[model samples]
Structures are given as structure tokens and as C-alpha cells.
Target: MVQINFAQKQVNAKIVYYGPGMSGKTTNLEVIHQRAPEPNRGDLTSISTDGDRTLFFDFMPLDLGTVAGMRTCFQVYTVPGQVYYNSTRKLVLQGVDGVIFVADSSPDMMEENLESLRNLQENLSEYGRSSEEIPLVIQYNKRDIPGALPIEVLEEKLNQRGAPAFEAIANTGQGVFPTLKALAAAVLDSLHKSSGSSVPASAPAAQPVAAPQAATAQPSAPAPAAAPAPQRQTISMSQTGFHKAPSLPLQGAAAPSEAQAPDKGARPPQNAATTPGPQALGGLQLKGGSEGDGGGLRMAQPATPPAPEQPPTQPSLSMAVPPQPPAAAPAPTQAPPATATATAKPQTPPANRPATPGSMMRPDGGSPPPRRAPASKSFPSKVQEAHATPKGGKPKSAALTVLIVVASIGLGAALGSFVLQIL
Candidate 1:
């Protein structure tokens, strides 16, 4: 287990010393601890069973000088080497970052050395680690023995990954530091590669090296121009089948719009419907004023009155015309017996007059169409008569109407008499 303590600027790793029983594993740790500077090493701890085997393991903390500004510490452990203590070995091997296999150099102990090596492999496999990747060093300990096996022979037999090997007499500390240093360096190298860090984690400046690249980045391109405002629909008298004028020209030969100019002084009529909206035509959006009102325009019918019997003969005349333009005091244009009567003898309707079709307009050079008093009776007056009690209860309205009629007749008669006198 290799842990980088970012908070303390320390790097801690576990180093396990593994070997067969009586193979001098503990001796190597003791030598390292004793030789390590007092300021750099922690207390050594050892626990053993009655059979002279390590009951648990030996633990010591060996601290080293700052490497790349990080305090380096190694937790050294030596597992019990007897075959019967295999469980303790596996437990001790957990999270081991590096392993030092101290093999006995005695020829008689070769089988025991091989057995311990196999034990190490099994323990590492149990933790899902491969000996090939872990930082490992081999020490042929008891090298001072006279009958020690040759280094070449030991290498051929027990060097699992061609790991670095050293001959060490653990009690005297011969080659001990070299083996330890090599394994420590290897473990640190692995840590650096895995972290993708050029310096140790203790160095805070590693992250700031990327600042220049960020500063060199170009400013974002100007945001795209705002989308153009959507096209707006416009209303026109021609399109709504309506006009603002009091009356169309008597010449009806020309369209009302072409005949009469707009009245600048006139305000929009209170009764004017809101501008017609463009309805979806098969999901197609049409341009404003593209459609004429005549497509659906018709005279608004009185709610209570029955629809009039349409003249079967004059189908063209019977079809209703669009609503008339509103006027403050409109002068009704009477249909002459010339244009309309020539086409059909259709009976005129009573009540609110229907729209006058333009076809009823007289030709040019013709006198203005005559106005009729009876045709001028307002529909509301008829409604008044129907609803009012007739026995003088509503006499004021009737008398007012009669007075207006008499005055109009008298004026006409006087004008005739005056014309006679002039003649």
C-alpha cells in the first residue's frame, strides 16, 4: 500500500520482508532500524509465539530524507516464516507496495527458500496482485555461511521477475541499504507514473504549470447576430372586406376603395371588429392582406328575425354582401329601377337593410340615385312599434316620427311651388 498524504506532504508505503523460518527476515529489519538515524526511525515492535515463530509480524517505521520535497516513510513488516504461519503471512502481505525476499544462502535451506517463495506468490495472488508488477528485491542472506549456494544458482531458481538481487549478511547490515534503496526508488517511480505528476504530491507548483495554456486561449467569437424580427401581419380595408367611409359612390362602376379616399378626421368606428387574424391554411403562413374579405364577408343577420326567403331566380343578387362601413349620419343610397331592376324583380327586405352590392351602382353620367323616405325607416323604430303599447302610451315617439315626415313633405312641396313660381 502506497499512500500519499497530501495534507502532511508525506508519502507512506508498506514494505514487507518475507522468507522461510529462521531465514533472517527479522534480522534485516532490526539492522535497518538500528542503522536508521534516530530522528528518522520509529520504535521497532515484535510479537512472537511460543514455538519461536513470529505469531503476528514485526513492524517498524523507517523515515527517509525528503524526496522531491515530500517526507518519505516506509512501514516495514516481517511475516512469520514457518509454513504453519501461512495465514499470518498473507495477512501481513495485504496492501504491500514492495517486497524484500530474504532467502537463506545455505545449500541445505534451498528447499525451504523455494517453499517460502511459493508461499509469497500464493499470498500475493490472494490479494489479486501479480509478483510481476510489484517492486521486489531479493537478498541472499546468510551469505557468510561457508556452504552457501552460488548467486547464479539462486537467481536461476528463485528470481521471479529478474528482480534486483543483493548478497547481504542481515546482522552486519551488508548490502541491506542497497536492497532497501532500490526497492524504495522503484516504488516511488511507480507512484509518480500512476499520478502523472512530475514532482511529489507535496509540491503545490505542479498544477500551476498549466496556467499559461489557459492564458493563451483565444476569446470566444462574437455571438451570432440576433435573429431577425419575425414578419408582422398588417390589416387593410380591402383585405377585411370593410371600409371606413359613410357611403360608396353612386357610380358603383368602380371599387369603393378606388372611389372614396380615407377620411383622416374620422376615428375608427366603435363597432368595428378587431382586425381579422391570419388563420393557418394547411400549416402554411400567408402574407398580411393577401386574402380579401369578400371570401367570407356577409351581412350580420338580426338574431330574432327569420332568414329571408332568397330569390331563387336572381342568385347573384340574393347572395348577401359584406357589412357596410360605419357612418355617424349615413345617407342611404337607393337602388334605381335601372341597374338592379333590370336584372331581377327581387322583393326588397324589411328592417336593417342588407349590404348593397356594388353591381347595383349606376353607370357614369347618370343622375345620382334617388333617396326614398319609406326606405329610410330605421329598423329600431319597427322594433319600438312591436314592443310598445299602441294606445297613445308610446304616442310621443309616433308623434315625433309623424312630425319629421310632415316637415319633410312640406319642405318638398314648398320647394316644388317655388320652382313653379320661378318658371
Candidate 2:
């Protein structure tokens, strides 16, 4: 697992070194701890038996510089290699981001190497991780010992996945840094792929510090040459094979020839070879000529000057009639005058007309047609009146008033009887 702390701007990952007992897993870590600078490495903690065999695990934290704005730290651990300690090995493997399988190259230890490798695969499977998916590397240790198996034999037995393999003699610290560097690069690549960030293959890989003279006392086959510094490069893996991603140019920098090549899917630019020149007017070619020459093109001569202006000519005036308004249509034919009685009689309401309920008669000597109460107001007002009325026909307020009057009358009668009795 890669733990990212945004507030701290830190990224921490775990890499485990796993192998059988006496495979120099501990030695590999010791070499790294000794070579790393004081600022870049942390105290190495180990739990081992009296014989110096690792009991639980060995932990060393290494600071690989910043990547994508986060300071990257790797907690490197070495699991106990004894067969009986499989449980402890599995515990150390938990949350591992990468694995370094250190195998003994001695001819006699071949079986032990095979067993350890199988154990690694099984444990990784238990965690729902696979050697194929995780960043993995193989280091064939004990290369300095006589009668050790050749690189080819080790590959045949242990390199089933074809992961990058390194030859190292951990006792002398030979091949130590290269192995670490390659594994770190692969781990970073895996992280970038998983995170969907652009993998920076061009970022320089860290170089290992030289080990103390005592650490390199023995010489393995002249330590394999350190891999050359990386160029502007990117690495990609596919089902077919590992392919190099085209190097992308830095911002504002010219791209390399390969990157500048047009993509097969893109359309070519129109007029890519030439820029548009100034336009010509009136069929004139303006190249290499003075501005006044009009590019040496022929022009129509100027026309003769116009005649001088003439004075105004007066016109004779005559009387002119103004337009008349449109004639009006003949007045509409008048209807015959209504006969007028000598005395006009006042209009009166018909005796058969019936007055509407709930309407008052008008006082114009004639009863206007009775008006009906508005239907909308009539229903709501009737509901309000019913709610306001008590069981009696009058409203509650009227009933209260009548009660007050009755009380007053009873009191007055009582007072009058008292007065009469007094008299």
C-alpha cells in the first residue's frame, strides 16, 4: 500500500526483501543502510536470534526524493527466511508495494530458492496481490562464492516472470545499489501507473553511495557495470512486450524529431509549407517597386476637368388652386319623426312584475327590476351567518344584548317592588 498524506506532502511505500535462510537478505539491507547518507537513511531495526539470524523482520527506511510534489519514503523490510517462519514472512509482506526476492546462487541452495519463490507467490495471492501485478525484482546473491550456479541456471529456475534480474554479492556490497535503484524505479513506475499520473522516465535515478572498504573486501565477478543514466525516456508494458514511450518535450521547449512527427490519426495542416502574402488589387503586382509607382502597372489617364459652375435660373410663378377636401357623402336618410303626444306620460312598472327577495325597491317613482345577490358572495355570507347565529334565529351578539336588557328589566322591577314596599 502507498500511503499519501496530503497535508504533510509525503508518500510512504513498503518494499519487502524475501528469501530462504542464509540467502543474505539481512546482508543486503545492511549494505544499503551503510552506503546511504545519514540524511537519506534512518536507523535500521532488526529482530534476530543469538546466531544473528533474523527472527521477525528487519526494517530500514530510505528517502527517495520527491516525485509529483510529494516526498517519497520507502520502508524497506527483510522477512525471516527460515521455512518455519512463514507466518512472520506473511506479516511482513502485508501492505507491501514491491518485492525483492534475494535468492542464494549456490548450487546446493537451488531447491531452497525455488521453495522460497513458491512461498512468495502463495503469500502474495493470499493478500489478493500477485507477483505479476506488483513491482518485483530478483537478486541472485552469493555470486562471489565458488561453484555458484551461473546466472542462466538461476533464471531458468526462478525468473518465470522475466522481471529485471541483477547479479550481486551482498557480502561485498557489489551490485547492491543497482539492484536497489532498478527496484525503486519499477516501484515508482507502478505507482504512477496506478495513480494515472504521467510517469517521468526522464527523472534521474538515484546513485548508490560507495560502501566502506571493509564492506567491499571481496570482489565478485567485476561488479556488473552500473546502468547508464536514463535519457528523456518513458517505459510502458503491454501484453506484447515492453515499449518505450515517446519522450515528451518540456514546456516551451522544442520537441524531439520523433515527437514532432504528425500523428497518424491527425489531419495535416493546410498550406503547411507557405504563409499567405499580401494581396494585390486591380490586377497589380506590387513586388520590388516604389510605393508611388503602383508596382509599375498601367493606369487609366485622368478625365478632363468638369465645366465651370453656372448661375441660378429664375422661374415664373402662376396662381395654383389648393386641393379641396373630399366631398362628404350625402347625409344618411332621416327616419320619419316619432309622433309626440300633447302631454308625455311617465313610465311605470308593470303590475304583473314580481320583486326579487332580499332586494330593496328604488325610490324613483318606479320600481327598478329587483337585483339578485351575487352568487359567489351569497353562499360564503350564508355560511358565515349560520356559524355566527346561535340555535336562535338571531346572532350571538344580539342574544347577548337581549339578555342584558332582560337583566336590566328584572333588576328595575325588583328595585320598584322594594321601593313600593318601603313606601
TM-score of each: 0.46, 0.48
> Scored by Cα lDDT, where does model 2 land?
0.51
Clashing pairs in model 2?
Answer: none
Q: State the C-alpha lDDT per candidate.
A: 0.50, 0.51
- RMSD to native for every prediction? 49.8, 45.6
Candidate 2 lDDT, 123-169, residue by residue in tens? 99999987778777678776545566877677778876656566654
Model number with the top lDDT: 2
**Per-residue lDDT value at 333 in model 2:** 16
Task: Name the runs in model 1 displaced over 4 angstroms.
Answer: 50-52, 194-423
By summed lDDT, the worst window of 10 consecutive residues in model 2 runs over 371-380
Per-residue lDDT of model 1, residues 250-367, tens digit only: 2333443222112110111111121111110001110111011111111111122222232222311122334676552132232222232111111122212222222122222121
Candidate 2 local Cα displacement, residue 413, angstroms: 96
